[model samples]
Target: MKKIETIHAVGHVLCHDVTQIIKDKTKGPVFRKGHIVTEEDIPVLLSVGKDHLYVWEKNENMLHENEAAEILFDLCRSEGMKGSEIKEGKIEVIADRDGLLKIDRKKLFAVNSLSEMMIASRHGDFPVKKGDKIAGTRIIPLVIEKEKMERAKEAAEGGPIFRILPFHKKKTAIVTTGNEVFYGRIKDTFGPVVKEKIAEYPTEFLGQTLVDDQKEHIQEAILHYIDEGAELVLCTGGMSVDPDDCTPGAIAGTGAQVITYGAPVLPGAMLLLAYYEKDGKKIPIVGLPGCVMYAKRTVFDLVLPRLMADDPVTFEELAALGEGGLCLNCGVCTFPNCGFGKGVVY
Candidate 1:
């Protein structure tokens, strides 16, 4: 840092804040630290009693906080994201569209581990709306060593650390499997609940098929829907381990690769996920447990957004959810905003 006359400080970065005092109205920083001195700012500095200013000395080996912030922004910006204008050595990553947010946790951790720089973000693997603030980046010092920023870049080498996967419109079909519903013994309440939940996404409902608990009947209905150009199929009921519960077997009989039949999550532990491959296309098929029909939030809520974005869920990822799988079932039910499914995988 070097001292320079306020008049000659134009185009230089302020090393410290210049406070302004008013008789009774206000007394605060007229110019914050890291503010670039401009010709228009000179009069304000003078009125604030700053005859001279301490400014950061320009150096090739050191980077101003704003410059370092740009570097951090580059590490996070992706196709569906935008960066806020730099201010006070900080830049914010914002979503350009509604989608599922994915974060490379390992790389995010490594870069933040580097002292003097930080990238704070919302939880990953969840839905984010347009214009949402996804993350923020900044450096601790007024200026940082250029070499340290280079290491940060290397730590996040593969690509941007954050990405938004936009939801895709899907032609979806529902298979309601239960003898009581098929035989008109009980009201089909589950189908209505599933429809309401899926309505949050872009979907074209292809009608619901009611089937008895017979494995062959359930399998036939699933195949019929796929043959009818359904991009996604949801089967409700018969997910338990009872002798008559044959939804899981029916889904397996359809030749879809089952990702997982059970999760470590409450109200959704019996969930089944699978994908059917045909003509170079993979269509998703899900078997939802009973809890999804009555519970305010369940494992289904945790995985639906990801599925809507066409992001695949793995067994390991589902296993990691065990840490935060138990929903408290709050009276207000603020999910995703709650800790129900926010366990750290790394």
Candidate 2:
């Protein structure tokens, strides 16, 4: 750090905050610490002080915090992402569009391991909107060694360390299976629930097919939706072991690849995930357990964004969710922001 005449301190970052005061009116920082001095700032500093200011000094071996932050930003910079101007030596990376955020957690960890620097971000595979703050980078010290920045650059060499997979608009169809619903004994509530859950995604409900627990009827509905150009087919109810439950059988009967008959998550543990092939490309078909109709959030909530981005989940990945599978069922459901299904990432 260096102390210089306030007029000549232009272009240097402040080392300490300059407090401003007015009798009984205000007494707070006029210029925050780490603010870069500008030509206009001279008069402000002169008004607060006599003539001198403390500022960061240029050095060959040690780089200024802003410079270090730029290098870190460059390391992870990529399409669909942009960084803000340096503020207090910190730079925040933001998403450029609505999509599923993918974080290179392994590489992200490596970069943070370096001393005197830090990077923090939201978990990967979550949905994000335009301008959402994905990550932030900055140097811990006012300045850092040039070599540390080089190491960070090397750690994030390939494509951006963070990226977004844009969601593809999909025409969707729903199949509600249950003797009660099919026979009109009880109202079909599952169809509306599924639609509400996927409201944010680029999806439209083609139509709903209410059918009995007949496996053949369920298979027919799925095939009909695929024929109608439905990219996603969601089946609700009849997922339990009872003889009346036949949604899983119906999905398997259509020759669709069943990825998992049951997941590790509670409230949606009986969920079934599958893929149906039409022509050459495969379409996703999900069998929703009864709990989905009542639960505010479930495993389905955790996987919806990924599906909308067309990123399919694997059996092992769903199995691993058992770690953070149990929900606390808090009175106020914060969901995605909460700990439920966090195991899906770890």
Candidate 3:
């Protein structure tokens, strides 16, 4: 840092804040630290009693905080995301559209391990709305070594550390499997509940199909939906281990690759996920447990956004949810805002 006359400080970066004093109106920083001195700022500085200023000396080997913040932003920005304007040595990553947020945990950890820099973000694999602040980045010091930033770039070599997969419109069908409903013994409450939940996404409901708890009947209904160009098929009820439960077997009978018939999460432990590939397109077929029919927030809430965004859920990823999968079932539910299924932090 070097001392220079306020008049000559134009284009230089201030090393410290310049405070202003008013008799009764205000007394605060007139110019914050790291502010670049401009010709128009000279008069304001002099009025604030700053005859001279301490400014950071320009160096070819070093990057100013704002410059370093841009580099960090570059490492995290991806489609469906935008960076906030640099301010106070910081930049925020904001969602440009509603989508599912995905982060490369390993690469994020590697970059954050570097000295004098940081990147803080919301948990990945969750829903994010447009204009939401997803992540923030900045440099700790006023200036950072250029070499260090280069290493950060290398750490995030493959692609941006953060991504937002926009939701895709899908033609969806629901098959409610239960003899109680098919035989008109009970109201078809589950189908209505499933429809209400899926209504929040960009899906075209292809109407509900009622099937008795018979493996062949269930299989026929599921195949019928797929043949109708349904991109997603949901089977509600008949997911338990009871002898009459036939939804799981019916889904497998359709020759779909069942990813998992069980999960570590409660209220959804009996959930089944499978995919049927035909003509190069993989259609998802999910068997939802009874809990989703009545519970305020279940495993369905955690996985629905990813599915709607066309992001496939892997077995390993589902296994990681065991840590924070149990929902408190609060009287007033605040799902994604709460930590119901955000356990596996890398």
Which numbered prediction scores highest in TM-score against the true structure?
1
Task: Report the number of the highest-lDDT candidate.
Answer: 1
Q: What TM-score goes with each of the models?
A: 0.92, 0.85, 0.91
The regions of model 3 sitting more than 4 angstroms off are 1-12, 19-28, 34-53
lDDT of 3 at 58: 81
* C-alpha root-mean-square deviation, candidate 2: 3.5
Each model's lDDT comes to 0.92, 0.85, 0.90
lDDT tens per residue, model 3, 241-283: 9999999999999999999999888879999999999889999
Query: Ten residues in a row with the worst lDDT in model 1?
Result: 337-346
lDDT of 2 by residue, 1-346 (tens): 7778998988888876789898999998999877898999889888987399878877798887878888888777677889998866799999999899887877888888887888898877789889999988888887789988888877776437888999998999999998898899999888888988878788877999999988899899999999999999999988899987888999999899999998889888898999988888889999988898898888888788888998878888798889888988999988778778877545
Q: TM-score order of candidates, best first?
A: 1, 3, 2
> Considering only N, C-alpha and C atoms within 3 Å, which residue pairs clash in candidate 3?
none
Summarize candidate 1's per-residue lDDT along 40-123 as a digit string, tens digits: 999989987899998999899998888888989999999989999887689999999999999999899999899899999999
Rate residue 96 of model 3 by lDDT. Answer: 93
User: The CA-based lDDT of model 1 is what?
Assistant: 0.92
Instruction: Find the number of clashing residue pairs for candidate 1.
Output: 0
lDDT of 2 at 173: 90
RMSD of each: 2.6, 3.5, 2.7
Candidate 1 TM-score over all chains jointly = 0.92
